[model samples]
Structures are given as structure tokens and as C-alpha cells.
Target: MTNSRQKIKKKQQDVVRFLEANKIEFEEVDITMSEEQRQWMYKNVPPEKKPTQGNPLPPQIFNGDRYCGDYDSFFESKESNTVFSFLGLKPRLASKAEP
Candidate 1:
């Protein structure tokens, strides 16, 4: 049977492949926080440290890009242009302006 760590690793590898095949560059962001650590931070950290509606935690800062959520969400958003930039991939520019 595969362990949780192994499962996570496989997911990461798949993400890498998807980005490569699509010619979409991306930097791997590690946001795997331990359950205990997260709980402690939530309980002990000052209110200011806690995330608010107007100010979100800056997406996990990687090489340079800001990834706001799980890999799947990141994969879907065009705003993830920053991720592609980090991977040294070119951005797909829209040819026409919206009406």
C-alpha cells in the first residue's frame, strides 16, 4: 500500500509533467503544513497575523510566483501567468480586447 507521503510525491510529479507538456512553466510551491503547526498558529498568533477578507495570505511564495491554492486551481487560472514566468515559460497573450 502506498503511504501518504508517497501519494503526495506522485501528485507533485504529475503536476510537473502536465506543465511541461503544455509548455506552461511553473515553480513548485511547498505549502504542506503540519496539522499541529497550523492549529497552533491559528490559536496563538495575533489577530493581525491571521488572514482577513481584504488581505489574503500572499500565495505561497515560490521562486517568484504566487500560488494561492492547491495545484489544481493553480493549473486552471490564466492569472497563474506568474507561475509560468517563474518556470521560464512565455505567457499567452490575448490578441483582442473585450467589448
Candidate 2:
């Protein structure tokens, strides 16, 4: 696969892995399988978020009809420990594990 494709795949995997690890429910939409879904994603993404040259790529995060963000934003939130808020999810309560 091309480098771009590889990067996209890696990003998608990272997002999925994190969500799975945290037990967050998510729907993985494959735009390639349905043009309607693809168009809906493109349309839902804000104009400011879209690339200047072409349509936005996959792995776009959302909460129902609410637009969360793209991979870059997701990564940023992850790094800053705010991914739950970024995903529009309430953070889970801490369990008693000596902390």
C-alpha cells in the first residue's frame, strides 16, 4: 500500500484501539462501501475542517449527528488526556484501586 494509505490505516487503528481499550462504543463506517455514507461524512464535516484541495478523508469522529473531529484533532485530545470530552463522552468514574 502507498504511504498515505498506510498512515491512514495506522491512524484508524490507533483510534479503534484506544476506544476498545476504554470500552467506548463506536461505529466504524467504511465509506468505500457506500457512497451515501461517504457523502454524509463529507457534508457533516465543517467547511473549515475540509482540506483546501480535496475532500476530507476517513476516520472522522462523531457523536450521532454531532461532529467531533478528524484524526489530527483526535490525536491531540488523546495526547492532552481529554479524549473522552473530545469524543463527547462523559469520563468514567475512578475505581478504588489504591489511588
Candidate 3:
């Protein structure tokens, strides 16, 4: 496979790892090579929400019917602990261990 493909695959794996580690269940889809899904995305998603890439890649997320951006946005949400709230899950409270 090409370097770009390798990179995309790695990113995809990383995102899955993060979700699993957090005990968050998610669905994965590969639209990179799916013309049918691409057409569906073009129609269902707003143009701005779509990536500016050649083939708008996968990892496109949706909470019910609302688009939640891509993996990058997902990561951002995870980092900020916003994903938990976004998914209607209780945010984990940080343990206050005396240092």
C-alpha cells in the first residue's frame, strides 16, 4: 500500500484504540474507496462538513443523525472530555489524590 494509505490506517487504528481504552463503543466505515457511500455523504452531509481531501475519508461520525465531524474532531472531543458529554455519557471525575 502507499504511504498515505499507511498513514490513514494508522490514524484509524489510533482512534479505535482511544475509544476502546475509554470503553466507548463506535462504528467504523471505510468510505475511502466506497463510491456509493461517497455519494450518500455528498447528499446527506453539508459541503463544509466534508473534508477537503480528494476522497473524503472514513471515520466520519454521527450521533444518531447529527454529524460529529471526523477523527480529528473526535480526538479533540476526547481530549477535552467532551465526547462523554456529547454522547450523553457521564464524564469521569478525576480522582483528587493528594500529591
Candidate 4:
């Protein structure tokens, strides 16, 4: 695989890992296999979010019909400890330990 393809695959895997770890339910669509689904994703993505040249890449996330953004946004949310919110999920309460 090409370097860019490898990076995309890694990013997709990372997103899946985080979602699974947090027990978030999501559907994975393989655009390469389904042109219709790929077109749907392209149309659903906000115009501002779409690339100027090519169609938007994979790992495009959504909560139901709501767009949650791509890998970079996901990584940012993870770093900021706001992934649950980013995924349109209610934040889980942090448990307190007895002193």
C-alpha cells in the first residue's frame, strides 16, 4: 500500500479502537466497495468540510445523520478529553475514589 493509504488505514483503525473502547455503537461503510454509499457520504459531508479537489476520504463519522467530522477532529477531541461529546454522546461521569 502507498504511504497515504497506510496512514488512512491507521487513522480508521484508531477511530474504531477508541469507539470500541468507549462502547460507542457505529456502522462502518466501505466506500471502495459501495459507490452509492460513497456518494451518499460525499453528499452528506458539509461543503466546508469537503476537500477542494477529490471526494472526502473514509473514516467520515456520523451520529445517526449528524456529521461528527474526520480523523483530525477525532484526534483533537481525544486529546482534549471530549471524545464522548464529540461523538454526540453524553459524557460519562468520572467516578470518585474514597480517600
The Cα RMSD in angstroms, rounded to one decimal, for candidate 2 relative to the true structure is 2.8
**By TM-score, how accurate is candidate 4?**
0.89
| Model 1 pairs in collision | none
Q: Highest lDDT, which number?
A: 2
TM-score of 2: 0.91
TM-score of each: 0.38, 0.91, 0.64, 0.89
Model 1 CA lDDT for position 70 = 43
Alpha-carbon local distance difference test for all models: 0.50, 0.94, 0.71, 0.90
How many pairs of residues in model 3 come into backbone collision? 0
TM-score-sorted candidate list, best first: 2, 4, 3, 1
Candidate 4 residue runs with Cα over 4 Å from true position: 94-99
Q: Which stretches of candidate 1 lie over 4 Å from their true place?
A: 29-65, 72-99
Q: Which stretches of candidate 3 lie over 4 Å from their true place?
A: 32-34, 52-55, 86-99
- lDDT tens digits, residues 16-51, model 2? 999999999889998989999999999999999999
lDDT: which is higher, 1 or 3? Answer: 3
Query: Model 2: residues >4 Å from true position, as ranges?
Result: 96-99
Native RMSD of candidate 1 (Å): 10.2
Ranked candidates, highest lDDT first: 2, 4, 3, 1
lDDT by residue (tens digit), candidate 3, 35-68: 7867776666667876687545655666666676
Alpha-carbon RMSD of each model: 10.2, 2.8, 5.3, 3.2
